[model samples]
Target: MYRYDNYDQTLVDERVTQFRDQMTRYLDGRLGEEEFRPLRLQNGLYIQKYAPMLRIAIPYGMLSSDQLRRLASIARRYDRGYGHFSTRQNLQLNWPAIETVPDILGELAEVQMHAIQTSGNCIRNTTSDQFAGIAADEVEDPRPWCELIRQWSTLHPEFAFLPRKFKIAVTGASSDRAAIQVHDIGLRLWRDDEGEVRVRVLAGGGLGRTPMIGDVVRDDLPWKHLLTYLEACVRVYNQFGRRDNKFKARIKILVKALGIEEFRRRVDAEWEHLKDGPQTLTPAAVEAAKTHFPEPERRPVSDEAIAAYEQQRQEDRALARFVTNNVTDHKVAGYKAVTLSLKRRELAPGDVTSDQMEAVADLAERFSFGEVRVTHEQNLVLSDVPVDQMVALWQALDELGMANPTVGTLNDIICCPGGDFCGLANAVSIPIAQALQERFEDLDFLYDLGPLDLNISGCMNACGHHHVGHIGILGVDKKGEEYYQVSLGGNSTDDASLGKILGPSFYREDVPDVIDKVLKVYVESRHADERFLDTYRRIGIKPFKERVYA
Candidate 1:
C-alpha cells in the first residue's frame, strides 16, 4: 500500500483545520446552510435521513492492515459500532456526530487517508480491480496510475464543481471486475505485441436515469500520456458538459448528444494544450509509485500441506464449498485468492462491524501479507492467502462471521441503503435485498443459475449499480405506493451494456415472484453451461419478458 509523504500529510492537516473552523462557524450562525452545504460535502459529511453520514475513501480499494485497524478505531470512537462499505470502494459511517466530523478527519489524516472527493459533484474515488497486483492475467499493476489520478483529482481547481458527480475506474487485467465500462472514464492497461504499456480509454459511460455503455475515445494511448489525456478529457467536459439540467449533466449524456466521433474530436483538440504539461507522467514517477507494490515472497512449503488441502476438499463438504466458492486461481502456484464475505445471512450487504473489522485486520496479518482490498462489488479480498493456510483462514473468518462463501451468487446482493437510511431514496432497498436472499436460500440452486448479479437501488441515482446487474431492480414510487422495476441482460465486463427494462414495474411484494418467473424462463431456455447473461443475450429479453409478465 502507498504511504503518505510530508506533502500529503500537510495538505490533509490543513484541510482538517479548515473544515473544523467551517463547522464552528456554521454552528455559530455565521455560515448559512446554503454556504455550508458545499463545505460539508467536500469534507464527506452528508445530512442523511436520521443523522449525518461521513464517507471515507479507500483509494483503488486497497488497504493496509494498519489502515484497517485505524478504520475500526474510527468506527468505535466516532460513530456506531459498524460502517457500511459502498459499491464505489468507499466506506460510510451512518451515525457520525456532525460536530465531531472534523475530529474524525483529523484522525483519518494520521493514517494517510481522508474523506475528500467521496461525495458531491466532483471527481469521486478512482476504483480498480480489487485483485490488481495479484491477478493472473494482469499486464501491469493498475494502482500506481490510480494513485496518480487520486492526487491529481483531489481538490482539482478546474473540476472542483461539475454538473454532477464523475467516476473513473481502471484495471490492468483482461477481466473487468472494476466495472470500468460504466464509469465516466475507464482505463484498461494492456501491453501490445511490442511489449509496450498502453491504456484503452473509454468515455461517456455511466448509469443513472440515463444509462449508457461508454464509447472508446482513445485506443492504446502511450502509458506516459495517461494523466495528460485524462486531464484533457475532463477539461473538455468542464467546458461543455451540461450544467442547466442535473439529469443530463454526466459526460455520458454529452457523449451521446454529440456522437462519439465529435466527442473524440473535441477531446483531441483539448489534449493539444495539456499533452506536455506538468501533469504528464514521467518514467521516474511511474517507477517510484510502482516501488511500493510488489509480489510477496514465496515460502518453502511441504507437500504434506498440499495433500492435506486436497484431502480436506475431498472429505469435507462445508470446507469444499468454501474453497470452491471463495477462492480464485492465483499466478503463483500453491497460492490462492481469498474473498472475505461481507454479506452474512440476515445482514445488510457490504456492512462490517468494528470488531469484525479488527478481526479482518488480524487475519490479514496472519494469513496474507498484511494487505486487504475492497472489491467493486462491495466485498473484501485477502489477495495472497496461501493454499496450505486456507483452512485455518476459513476457520478464523467463520468465527468473525466473515465466512459466507456466496461470492458471485444470488445471496451476494449489491444494494444501497434505501428509504430507511438515505433521504434521497424513494423506497426501501435493503429489505427487498433481504427478501430476495430469503427466497433464494438454496445455494445449489443459485450455483445452477450461474453467475447472476442482482443489483438494487432505492432510486434512479443508480448508487447500487442496478443498471449493470444481470438482474437489475430499481425502486419506484407511484402515487405513494412503493414499486420495483426490473431490467435484464446488463453486464459490466469488457462487453458491458446497460440492462433493458422487462415491462411494467411490480409492487415490492411481487418482485421476487417476478424474478422467479424470469429465472424459470432462463432455466428452461438455457443451453448446457451457459451463464445467465449469456443466455439472456443469446435468446434476447423477449422470452424472459414474456414469461415474467405472462
Candidate 2:
C-alpha cells in the first residue's frame, strides 16, 4: 500500500481545517443549504434520508490493517457500528452527525485516509483492480499510477468543478476486473513490442441517463506522456461537456454527440501544447513513485499449497466450488487471492458488522500480509493468502459468517442501500437482492449457470453499477408504486457494452419471475459450456425479450 507523504499530510490537514470553518458557518446561518451544498459535496458529505452520510476514500481499493482497524474504530465511535463499502471501493458512514464530520475527517487524516474527492462533479476516486499487486496476469502493478493520479486530481483547480462527476479506472491485468470500460477515463496498462510501458486510453464512458462503453481514443500511448494525454482529456471535457442539463452533463453525452473520431481529434489537438511540457511524466519520477510500492517479502516454500489444493479438489466439492469462485489468481506461486464474501446471502449484500470487520482485519494480518482490498463489486479481498491454508481459511470465514461461496454467482448480488437508508431511493434494493438470492439458492444449479453478475440500483444514480451487470436491475417509481426494470447482456470486460432495456419495468412482485423467464430461455438456448453473457451474445436479446414478455 502507498503511504502518504508530507504533501499528502499537509493537504489533508488544510482541507479538514477549511471544511471545519465552512461547516461552522453553515450552522451559524451564514451559508444556506444551497450555498453550502457544493462545499459539503466536495468533502464527501451527503444529506441523506435520516442523517448525513460521509464517504471516505480507499485509493485503488488498497488498505493496510492499521487503516482498516481505524475505519472500524471510527464507525464504532462517531457513527454507527458499521460502514457501507461502496461500488467505488470507498466506505460510507450513513449516520454521522453533520456537526462532527470535521472530527471524523481528522481521524481519517491521522490514518492517511480522508473523504476528499469521494464525491462531487470533479474527478472522483481513481480506482484500479483490487488485486493489482498480486494478480498473475498483470503486466505491471497499477497502484503507483493510481496514486499519481490521486495526487494530481486532488483539489485540481482546473477540474474542481466539471460539468459532471468524473471517474477514472485503470487495470494492469488482461482481465478487466476494474471495470475500466465504464469509467469517464479508463486506462489499460500494458507493454508494447519493445517492452516500453504504454496505455490504452478510453474516454467518455459512464452509466446514468445514458450508459456507454468508453471509446478508445489513444492506443499504446507511451508511459512518459501519460500526464500530458490525461491533461488533454480533462481540458477537452471541461471545455465542451454538457452543462445545461444535469442528466446529460456527463462526458459520455459529449462523446456520443460528437463521433469518437471527432472527439479524438479534439483531444489530440489539445495534446499538441501539452506534449513535451514539464507536466509530462519522466522516468525518474515514475521510478521514484514505484519505490513506494515495493513487492512484499517472499519465502520460497516447497509448494505445500498444492497438497491442500488437491485435497480441496477431492474433499468437499462445495469447498472446491467456494475456492474457485471466491479466490482470484495471484502473481506468486504458493499464494492465491481470496475474496471474503461481504455478499453473505444471510445478510445484506455489502453490509459488514463491526465484529466482522475486525475479524477481516485479523485474517488480513495472519494470512494476507496485513493488507486488504475492497473491490468495485462490493466484496472484500485478501489478495495474497498462502495457498496451503485454503481449507482452514475457508472454515474460519465460514465460522465468522463471511463465507457464502457465491462470488460471481446469482446469489452474489450488488445492491444499493436503497429506500431503507438512502433518501433518494424510490424503493428498497436490499430486499429485492435477498428475494433473488433465495429464489436462486441451489449452488449446483448456479454453478451450472456460470458467471452471472446481478447488480441493482435504487434509482438512476447507478451507484450499484446496474448498467454493466450481466443482469442489470434498476428500481423506478411509477404512480406511487415501486417497480424493477431488468436489462440483460451488459458487460464490463475489455469488450464492454451496456445492456439494452429488455422491456417495460416490472412491478416488485413480477421481478423474480421475469428473471426466471429470461434465465430459462438462456438455459434452453445456450450452446454447450457457454456462459450467460456468451449465450446472450451468441443469440441476441430478441429471443429472451420474447420469452420474457410473452
Candidate 3:
C-alpha cells in the first residue's frame, strides 16, 4: 500500500542497473562464483539445487493488487508459473535463471517491490501482524512502525553484513500473531496509562540448532525511541555477535553466551550516544509514516444486513464452517478479514500459481479495497471484506480452490521448500507436509483435533517456524539417509515456548503413522474443549512420546 516516491524509485532503478551489470560480469567470467556470491545474495538471489531462487520483499506483508498482479506476470515470464510465500511473508521464485534475475528485479521495481535486504546476514524484512489496523484488539497499528523500520534497515550501511541473518518482527495486537518472541528483535506495541505509545522489546530469540524465546530486554520503551533503541540493539549485535562460525552467529547465540543482563547493559550504553541523535523518531516523522497506511473507507451496515449474513451462514453448514475457520473479526462494524487458504491438499503449502495470484488480485480489488495482506502462516488475507458480501466472496473463493476451510487446522501446515528446491535442506519437507494433509483431509477429524499447528522444516534453519508449531517435524540426515525428527508442545503465542524432541528420528515412511499416533494420544488424553497444545502442555510430552515411539 506504500507507493514509492521519487527517491525510492531512483534507488530501486539504480540498484537494478547495478545488478544487471554485476550479473553480466559474472556470466562473462570477469567475476568468479565466490566473488559474485555476496553481490548476488545482497540482491536476494540464491543459487539453489536446480536454479536460482529470487526472494522479493513484500514489506510487512502488504501488497497492492497491482503489485500482486505484477508478481504473477513476473512468475509467468521469468520462472515457473508459480511462487512460494515464505514464512517471512516474502515471495520466492525458485526456478528463476541466474542470468534473468536482473530482468525480474526490473519488473519488481516497476511495481515498487524489490529483493533488497531480503537475504545475506543483513537486517531482513521487518514483519508485523497481518491484520494490523483491522484487528479488534490492536493497541496501535504497527505497520507505521514496521514501515519506519523498513526504511531505516533497508541498505543500512551499519548493518549491511551482520554476523548472520537478522529478523525483526512487530506486533500491535494482544495476540502474538507475528511471532515476535522468535525474532532477533521483537517489538510489542501498546499504550501507557496516559495513552502514550510504548513498546516491549524482546531480543535473542531464534530457532535452528538452538531454539529460544526472545528475552524481554526493554519492558517499556517509548515509541519515539523505537528506531534509536533498535539501532543500539543491532549495533551491539553487529559488534559482538559471532562471526567465527555461521551456525553460531545469530543474535540468540550471542545473547545466550553473554547473558541478558550484560546484553541489556551494553545496549543501554550504546543507546546513550545514539539516543536523541539523527535516528530518534519525532512526531512529524511518525505521522508521515502513518500516512502510508490510512484506514480503508468503512461503511456502516444496517441491522438487516447483519441479520441476513447470520441467516445465510446458519442455514448452510458449509458456509458456517468456512466462516468459522477462515473469517476473523474486524475492528470496524459489519466488516471481516478473510484468509485465502493456501494449504489445500492438492498443492504444497504457500505455493500460489500465477493464475491463483491473478485471481486473488482481482478478488482483493473486488472485495478488500484493492489490497492483500500475506500472513506469516503462509496465507493471503483480504483484510476488509464487508459482511454483506461474505457469502459471495466465500462462494467465489471456494470455486477458486482457495477455500479449504482449514485456517488453523492440522492440514493448514507451515512447510518449507525443502530438498526439492533448497540446497541447504538435508531432506524433502513438502512430501511430509503433503502426507499429513492427505491423512488429515477429514474436516471432522481436524475440527475435533482443534487448532493444531503442524510445521515442517527440511533442516534446522527453521524456515518453516517448526520450533513453534504445536507439532514440529524437522528433517534430519543420518549417514545420507533421510529421517524426520518430531517435537511437541511448541507454541508461538503470547506465552511462546519451544517444542521438546519426542525421541530419535524416524524413517520418512513412518512419519505419517507417527503423527497419527501422537494425535491419537492427544485425542484420548485431552479434556473437554482442550487444544492439542493445551493438552500437551498439561499432560506433558511423555504420553505423545510413548505413543509415537511405542
Best by lDDT: 3
Candidate 1: deviation at residue 157, Å?
1.6
TM-score winner: 3
lDDT tens digits, residue span 1-550, model 2: 7887898899999999999999999999999999999999999999999999999999899988889899999899888798889888999999999999999999999989999988899999999998898888889789999988888888999999999999999999888889888899999999988888999999988887778888899998999898889999989999999899989999989998998999999999999999999888888889888998888886554655577676766788878888879987777888889998887656677788777888899999888889999988888999877777778889999988777888889888988998878998978899899889878898888988999999999988887788888999999999889998898888888778788789899988888899899889999999999999999998999999999888
Task: Residues 27-145, candidate 3: write the lDDT tens digits.
Answer: 99999989899899999999899888999999999999999999999999998899999999999999987889999999999989999989898999999899998999999999989
Q: Estimate each model's TM-score.
A: 0.98, 0.97, 0.99
RMSD of each: 1.3, 1.4, 0.8
What is each predicted model's overall lDDT from 0 to 1?
0.90, 0.88, 0.93
Span of 10 residues, lowest total lDDT, candidate 2: 299-308
lDDT of 1 by residue, 298-391 (tens): 6855778878888999999888888888888887777888998888655788899999899899999998889999987888999988888988
Stretches of candidate 1 exceeding 4 Å from the true structure: 302-304
**Model 2 regions lying over 4 Å from their true place:** none
- How high a TM-score does candidate 2 get? 0.97
lDDT of prediction 2: 0.88
Which structure is stronger by TM-score: 1 or 2? Answer: 1
